[model samples]
Every structure is written in C-alpha cells, then in structure tokens.
Target: MAATIIDVARRAGLSTATVSRALRGLPNVSESARARVQQAAEELSYTVSPIASQLSSGRTGAVGVVLPFVNRWFFGQVVSGIDSVLRANDMDLLLYNLGDTRVHERFFERMPVRRRVDALIVLTLPLSEDETRALSSLAVPVAVLGEPTPPFWNVRIDNSVAAATAVRHLVNLGHRRIGLITGAAHDPRRFATPILRRDAYRTALEAAGIRYDPRLEAMGHFGIEEGAAAMAQLLTLPEPPTAVFAESDEMAFGALRTLRRMRLRCPEDVSVIGFDDHETAHLMDLTTIAQPVVEQGALLARLVLKALAGSHEEPSDTVLPTRLVVRGTTGVARRDAAPGVPPSPGAATDNGTGARGARSPVP
Candidate 1:
C-alpha cells in the first residue's frame, strides 16, 4: 500500500499524532523522535497522500482575514496589499467583518474559524483583554496587521509619533490656531485614535507655545461624511481655524469636500492635512503622512506564511516609520503678512499609537 500516516507511525514506534506532527515539522516532537520518524518514512518509501492528508487535517487550505470596516480608505488599501501577497503565495483568503460589537462578538466568540483556516491576520480593532485571551488559545497560528499583538506575530507603526510629525509639519508652518478634527474615536475613554492623535496634537501645540482649545476640536466617525460634518461645524465659529490636521485621508477628503462646497480654497482659506497617503490623497493633492501600508501588508502576510510552514519561532513585533508628503492641500497658515487676518494660539499634551491591522477580515 502507498505510504500512510498510520504506516509511518507504526514503523517509527510513535503514536500517529506524533508522526503527523513530525511530518509537519511542528516543534513539540523531540529531535530524536523526528529523526526516527523521518528514517522510518524513507524506509517505507512513504509519500504523503494529498487527499488523505486533507481528510485527516483540519485546515481548509485558507487564510482568515479579520478587519473592521472595509469601506474606509486605509482599510481598503491595506486589504488590496494583503490580497496581492496571498494571491502570489497560492493561498485563498476568507473574509470576516467586525464593524460593530455584535458582528465582532458573534464570530470571534463562536470561533467558527477554528480549523477552517490555517492562519489568521487581524487588521485593527484592539482586542480587549478577554478577546486577546481567547485569541491566544486558538488552535491555528495568528498574525496581526495593525496593532502589536502579544504571543503572536505582528507589524505596526507609532501612532503618537505619526500624529506628532503631522502636527509638527503645521507647527513648522507657523500655524498657531491649528485645529484638529478627529472623530468619536478621539475620546479615548470611549474610542481609540482620537485620544492618541489628540495627545500628539497637544504635544506639538505646547511645544509651539499654543494653548489647547477644546472649542477648536470636533469629533466624527471614520468616514468622509464625518469629515464634512466636522468641517461645517468648525466653519461658523467666530474664530475659524487657520489650519486643520485630520487623522485620516477619508476625513481630510471630507474636509476638502466641505471646503469646496463652501467655495473656500485649501492652504489659502485654511490649510488641510490628513493621515494615510491613500491613492485618493494623491488624486486630491492632500498633504499628509505617508504610512508604508502596502509594505506592512507584505510583512504581515509573510509572518502568516511562516506560521503555516511550521517555522514560527518566538513572537515578533515590528514597527514601521512614516514620512511627510507635501501636496496642495496644506500651506502656510493664513496669518501671513497679508492685509486681513488675526493671530492665533495653541494647546499642549503628550501621547501614543499602533499599526499592524490587515486586510481580509480585520478592521
């Protein structure tokens, strides 16, 4: 008979499970046990039967992609990057959505993905202690794309630094009355990035001798509509901001839309800045921080692939860098010696960040 896992186990003097694990190069087996298994398999002229192996293995020859909201710009682009890598690797991707708690809980808690995918790539949502705890016990390997995941492979960026850098760009341009338009997420006690970026905004403003003005800030969700909503609210105030730094390109684009609708020009009426140098940013000529999103995807994908190959060592955490890409969206603060404009003040605070969320199923 052609070689089978049972035959290999019988010849190696080990249990079928041990022999199976040895063939996959999984670590728990001792070196001596592996050697014996290898030798026996050779003697039996054993070659794994693909069909039989599939019947015995739980893996479905697929990778799980966990993401938050797929409709947003950054998440969508990052997904595109991951898809490219997975396609080249000859693997299929399974997608899941976690835009809300119900959707997130139903899938993650039920653990339907168990045995369905060989590995998982988490994009954004910061798993709570309970969620993180459950994920750690999963049977399959995991690779995180956005934030640094413990006891697993991951890649990310420094959010505090990125926000500081973007804010600093405006500070350098002499924008004292620079306003930060974040979203519902800005209230860290309630959401994620809002607080981090707000802190970075504060730090940069304080360094530039400005007082933090709560009145100058507005909040919205992670969408273009929210950006427009925030901008419209900011416009009617007695003292409109001279410059604005949005946390994402979607918001920035929304700001752009509001500005256009109001017949106000960017950098001229008010300078606008955004995060994530997405393709739309280039099209809109938005000045912003360019994160290595696609490259991050490649790195995250490689980590998942390594786990699939049973070569995963200790868990790894990687942090990538960001750069400023100047475009038409931002310019010198309106206070330029022009005939008609007033001066402005600033605010201050310290802060943080994370990256490594991926495409496929994560947010």
Candidate 2:
C-alpha cells in the first residue's frame, strides 16, 4: 500500500500537523524537524496530496491564460512559451479562449476563473471599462500582452515603430504610391495592435511626403482569404500602389497568392511586406518586421510569477524591440513604370534594393 502523511509522521516521531508543515517548507517548523520529516518521507515513500497541499497553501497552483484565438499561429506560439515557463515551475495552465462574442461576454459575466487560478495573463484583447473592472474584481495578479493597462503588468513590442519601419523600407526603395492591408478599420473588438499599426502606416507615409490615399488602404481583417480579397481590390483601383504592407504574414501569403493568380511578379510589379516574421515567412520569402513572439510570452509569465510571489515592485510596462527583416518580397520601384499603369512584362526585377540581408533600422 502507498504510504501517506500519517506514515511519514509516525516514522519522523512527530505530530501529523508538524509533519505537514515541515514537508511543505512552511514556517514555524525547525530545521531539525524539517530534516527529520524529509528523511521520514523518503524512508516511507510518502507523498503529500496535491489537492491537500493547495488547500493548505491557499493557492490554486495554476495560471489562467485568456486570449482571442487559440488556433492562430501567433497565439499558439505565445501559449507554448507561457506553458514552458509555468511547467518548469511545477504549475498548471488553464486556457480561456474568448474568440466568440457570446463566449467573451459569458466569460466576463460568469467570472469562472475568479478563484480557480493563482494569476491571469490577457493577450491582446481590448477590454471595456466594465470588463476591466470585472477582471480587477477577480483579485488575481494580471498581466497584459499587447497594451499597457495601468496597475497590470504589460509586455509588448512597439507596434507604431514596427509598422513605420515596414512602410519606410518601401519608401526608401523609391516607391511613391504605397498600399496598406490592415485588420483594424472595421474590427468591432477594437484590438490595440491593428489600430496602432494603421496609424503608424499613415504617419510613415506623411513623413515620406507621400499623399495619404484612402483608396490605397484595404481592410483584410488579418485573414488569408480576407487578405486575398483585399489585394484584388487594391489591384482594381485606377492607380494601384506599387508596394503594399500587410499587417501580418498570413495576410501577406494571401496577397502573394493574389499576385500569382493575376500573373503579376512580386517586387517587379508589386512589392509586398508583412509583419510578425511567422514560422512560414521565410518559406514564403516575405520581408517583415520581426518581433520576439515567444520571448514576449515568456516575459509575461515571469512577471505574473513575480506578482504572485508578492513582489512589491511597481507594475512594469516592458516594450520589447522589433526589427526590419528584408527578404526577396520587397525591391526597388520601377522608374519607368508610370502612375495608374502596370510595369511592362519585360521589365527587369530590381533585386539590388531591399534584397535579402538588407535591414532597415527600427526607430
């Protein structure tokens, strides 16, 4: 039969309560008592019940991760990173995917994770005032991934700077007319990332002395199909842009597909750039703004652990750095190509500019 705490207490010649306290490394237990309990536990092969330990410690031994989409590549990577840290620390992860509007509302209304987790990690979801209050009422340590919410730990990259770097790369390549494929324009959730990137795109264009043309911008909603449709729409415009910046690699893949279907060569006809440097970005040969997706997730987990340990430090807002990774997808604009007209079929590709190994400085 498996040995229990009672067996350990008998072997150590101590009361059951003292054995429990010593085995848990709790205070009020002398060093000698702790040593005796440890030896007794080893000799008797006794183990403490995880449930009982949690009950005595007043902690759930699990962390809750809340995000919009679980299936998306970005979120998947982040979760993996978080799980790595938590698993190493002997803790559990409870995921809450609030992808659907009803589910999101229900989660906030029910407050299911209130006492079930030791801490919470929110990923890139824009919370309303009521929702924020609801999360605060949970009384758990909270960390946010994308935006800085006061009184909560935050870990994120500079979206505005990253987006501007992508646009500036194309402008430096002598592309006067640039297009933007973004997910923020019509999103009801009002996610902070897309909005910041969109505003940066406009600001970058103005800085480059290019006119802000609404017709050059299309809403992809950060999906492959939506990106394909948005690309087609941009191609149909009277004066199509020679370069396009997609807010995500998935969307950029769709744009590349659209270019193939229309028999237009990348860079030679339409230079395309994307963000996130996703796993498949290199396979697609996409130029993008690369952020440390896994690192950000791991940092957030560390911050939560610190908060859980009763760290008195002020809530930290950590903004990680992003870099421009130039690949084959972006190139110099065709000098001979006129506005409102596509370049000639025989036009040579401008591979010298924005080629692989070329990197734009992130400001």
Candidate 3:
C-alpha cells in the first residue's frame, strides 16, 4: 500500500499536523522537523492523495479558469502561462469557455462552482458588477485576468497604452493621415476591450493636435474577415489614409492581405502597425506593440493560489506596460499625386515626433 501522511508522521516521530506543515513547506515547521519529515516520507514511500488532502484540508487542489474566448491567440497564450505555474503547484486546471452569452448566463445562474474547485480565474469574462457579485457569492477565491471585471484579484495589461503605442508608431513614421480599426462599439457589453483601445487612440491623436476624423476610424469584428474589410473600406476613401493602426495583429494580417489584393505596396503607399506582437506579426514583418501575455497568466495563477489560501481579499487591477517594436511596415509618407494634383512637397520626414500635422498635405 502507498504510504500515507500518518505513516510518514509516525516514522518521523512527529504529530500529523507537523508532518503536514513540513510537507507543505509552511514557515512554522522547524528545519529539523522538515528534514526528518522528508526523510521519513522517502523511507516509507509516501505520496500525498490530492483528493484526500482536499477533503480533509478543505481545498479542492483544482482551479477553474473561465475565459470568454479561448480560440483567440491572446487568451490561449495567457491560459498556457497560467497552466505552467498551476501544474508546478500540483493543481489541476478546469477550463470553461464562456464565449456565448446564453451559455455563460446559464452557468453563472446555476452557480455550479460550489465545492467543485478551490478558486476561480476569469479571463476577459465580459462580466458586469452584478454578475461578478453573483460569482463571488460562491464563497471561494476568484482571480480575473485581462480587462478588469473588478472586485476580484486582477492581472491585466493597459489597453490604453497599447493603443497609444500603435498610433504613436504610425504618427512618428511621418504618416499624418492615420486610420484606426478596432472591435465594434455597437455592442457595449460584448467588446469592452476594443472600446478602451479606441479611447486611447483618440487621446493620443488629440495630444498630437490631430483632429479625430470619424472617416479614419471604423468598427471591426475581432477576426480576419473584418480586418480585411476595414482596410478595404479605409483604402476606398477619396482622401485615403496614409497609415493604418489595427488593434490586433490578426486584424493587421487581414489588412495586409487587403493591401496585397489592391496592389498597394507597404511603406510605399501606406504604413501599418498592430498590437500583440503575435508570431505571425514577425513572419509578416509587421511593426507592433509587444506585451507579456503569458506573464499575465502566471500572475493570475499566483493570485488564484492566494485566493484559495484565503490570503487574497483586496481586489486589484494591475496594468502591465508595453513597448514599441519597429518593423518593415511603416515609413515616411509617399507622394502619390492624383491627376492635375499640385505637388510642392518632398518626402515628409518624421523626426521621431508623432503626429506633427493632421488633416494637412504631407510635408
């Protein structure tokens, strides 16, 4: 029979509580006691029964991670990061894909999380204050990841900063007529992240003395099809934008495809920038803003662990920073004259100052 904690405690000549503390590496257990407990466990071929440990100790040894969408690269990468740490801590992960409103509503309403897992982690769950309160009433630890659905432990990157970086990159590249494409704001409860991003983009433009052009901004679904369509729409304008900043790399990839179809060469006729530095972004030589998605996951794991231990009570919204990544997609505005167009300008130099002029002919 596999040795149990009782067997190890007996061999170590210590109480079962001390042996448990030593095995869990709790600070109260002395070093000598810990060493003896370890040796005794090895001699007895002892292994912990996670199920029994939870039953007796009142912990499930498992955590439930709820994400609105797992198919997206950003959420998948964050979940992968969370899994890495939880596995090391001997915790099992149960994933809940609550992408659909109907499914999520039913799940939250049923409140099935009671006693099923020690803690919960939500990734951009599209939750309101009332829904968050309902989940908290489950009386277990909860950690939120990405786009804060607050009154819970949170780990997220600043969406506004991310948006600003993309716009600034285009502005600094001598592209004054810059367009922004992001998730649709038509649905408030659905696409909150994109709305925050658009706010940041507008703020950056305003700071640079650029008049926010409604024509230069469009709503897009968070996928390739919308990305392509958004780009095509921007290009079709009579005074087409010289640059495009997409809220996501996947969307930018779609835009790139659109540019190819129209024979519009990058950095010659237009410039492009995207966020999330996805692997494909590098393959396509796209400029972007890189943030640590996986690191956010690791933080979520730690937060959940704290919650399970009843140690994390105060909710927090943490914002990670971002940096600009220059690539082959952006450059000085190219002079493409229309028929009978008056040309009195040379190459528009950026001097690294973003958005020096808006709604004016390129210098």
Candidate 4:
C-alpha cells in the first residue's frame, strides 16, 4: 500500500500542514523542512496525491482552453502544441469547444471554468467589451492567442501585415484587378481579425494605386466549400479579376477548385494566393504567407504555466513573424485577351492544395 501525507508527516516529525506545504513547494516552508519532507517521503515510498495537493493549495492542476471551433485545422494544430506542454508539466487540459454563438453566450454567462482550472487560454474567440471585462474578473490567470487585449497575456501574428503581404505578392505578379476572399465577420466593429485582414486587403490595393472594387470581393466562412462558392461569384462578374487572394489556405484551395471546374488554368488565366502556409501548401504548390501557428499555441501554454507557478510578473505581448512562400499556384499575369478566356487544351495542370493543417515547422 502507498503511504499518505499523514505517514510522511509522522516520519518527518512535523505537522500535516507543514508536510503539505513543503511537499507542494509552497512558500513560507523552510528549505531544511522541505529537504526533510522529501527524504521522509522517499524512505516511506510515499507519493503525493495531485488532487489533495491542489485542493490544499487552492489549485486544480489543470488548464482550461476555450476555442471557437476545435475541429478546424488551425485550432487542431494549436491544441496539439498546448497539449504537449501540459502533458510534460503533469497538468491536465480541459477543452471547451464553443460550437456556435449560443454556446459562446451560455459559456460566458456561466463562466463554468471558474474554480475548475488553475489557468485559462482563449484561442481567437471574438468577444464583446462586456464579455472581455467579465473574463478579466475571473480568478485564474488568462492568456489569449490572438489580438492582445488589456490585462491579458497574448501571443499573436499581425493579421493586417500578413494580409497585406499576400496582396502585395499578387500585385507584384502584375495582377491589376485582384479579388479577395475572406472570412465573414458577425460585427465589423468588434475590432476582430476578419475586419483587420479585410481592411489590410483594401489598404494594400490602394497603396499599389489599384481601386478597391466591391465587385472583386467575396465573403466566405473560411471553409473550402464556402471559398469555392465565393470564387464562383467573383468569376461570373463582367470583369473578373486577373488574380485572387484567399485569406486562408482552405479558401485558396476552394478558389483553385473553382478555376479548375471552369477549365481555367491558374496563373495562365487567374493567379491564386492564400494565407497560412498549411502543410499541403507545398504539395499543391500554393503561394501563401506562413505564420507560426503551433508556436503561438505553445507560447500561450507556457505563459499560463508560468503564472500558475507563482510567477506574478505579467508577460510581454509576443508578435510572431510571417513570411510569404511562393510555390506553383502564383505566376506572372497573363496578357489581357477577351473577357472570360479559358485556358488552351494543352495548358499545364498543377496539383490542388488539399487541407493539411499540420503543425508548421517553426523557423
């Protein structure tokens, strides 16, 4: 049978509270006492119960991660990084997937994770000012993975910069009428990422002396199907764009599929670019702006763990770098011909970029 905390206390000739404090590395316990408790526990072959230790120390030995969607590729990669860190630290992970708006409302209204986790990590969930204030009032330390809000530790990439870079690539390829396919925003005024990326798209076009054409923009839910549908809408316009930039790799794939369905060749007919250098980007020969998605998740977990370890210092905001990867999808703009020109029968075909949101190798 395993020895309990009482047995260690008795062996070390100390009170149960002192044994608990020393064994758990809580402050106010002298180093000599801590050494004595360690020796006694070793001799008795006693192991501390994580649950009891947490209870006495006012901790839960777990971190809660709340995300808008768990099934998505980006979220999956982030969760993998966070899970790896938690496992090494002997802490458990409690995942709360807010499936939709109703779930988000209910979760925030209750704040069910209160007292259930030692720390919390929120992954790019757009919240209102009221909700943000409510979260700040929670007892546990909070870390966010996108756009840093006040009083919270954050690790994120500049969405606007990434978007601008993607646009610049298409513009440099001599694409005059560039179309944009981006995620739909519920509220454009929430100061969220969709708005930032969209605004950046327009800014980049204007800087290049190109007019921001409303007819050249399409909205999607950031899914492959939605992207394909949106691309179809842009393609049917009287003056279709010479190139298109999708806000995400999945959307880019959809656009590619649409072009293929229409028997139009990429770059030869329409250039396609996307953000997020997904694993399969190389496979599909996609040109995209790559961000450190997995690293962001790992960093968020590290911040939460540091706070849980009695480090009261606030961590500085971290902005990761992004780079544009040129692959097969993007090419020099083709000469203008009659509107809606299809590719020749012998036009070269490239592989489609299927969704492979694997953990990106950190540079």
RMSD of each: 10.6, 4.3, 6.7, 6.3
Model 2: per-residue Cα lDDT over 13-72, one tens digit each: 999999999888889999999999999999988888898999888899999999998888
Residue 218 of candidate 4: its Cα lDDT? 93
User: How badly does each model clash, as a count of residue pairs?
Assistant: 26, 0, 0, 0
Q: What TM-score would every model get versus the actual structure?
A: 0.76, 0.90, 0.78, 0.84
Write one digit per residue (lDDT tens) for candidate 3, span 1-363.
788888899899999999988887668988999999999998998876667667867778888888877788888999899899999998999888876778788888886777888888888767777788888887877888767675788887888878887888777765677888887566645666788888898998898877888998876666778898998889777777888889888888888888777656675566788888987778888888888889899998988787666673687888888888888887766544442121223333333355332322111
Sliding window of 10 residues with minimal summed lDDT for model 3: 339-348
Q: What's the alpha carbon RMSD for model 4?
A: 6.3
Off by over 4 Å in 4: 1-46, 187-191, 336-363
Candidates in order have lDDT scores of 0.76, 0.88, 0.78, 0.83
Per-residue lDDT value at 214 in model 3: 90
Model 1 TM-score relative to the real fold: 0.76
lDDT of 1 by residue, 138-186 (tens): 7677888756768778888888899999988887877777887885563
User: Who is ahead in TM-score, 2 or 4?
Assistant: 2
Lowest-sum lDDT 10-residue window in model 4? 354-363
Positional deviation of residue 187's Cα in model 4 after best superposition, in angstroms: 6.3
What is residue 210's positional error in candidate 4, in angstroms?
1.7
Model 3 C-alpha lDDT versus the unseen true structure: 0.78
Candidate 1 wrong stretches, greater than 4 Å: 1-53, 186-191, 336-363
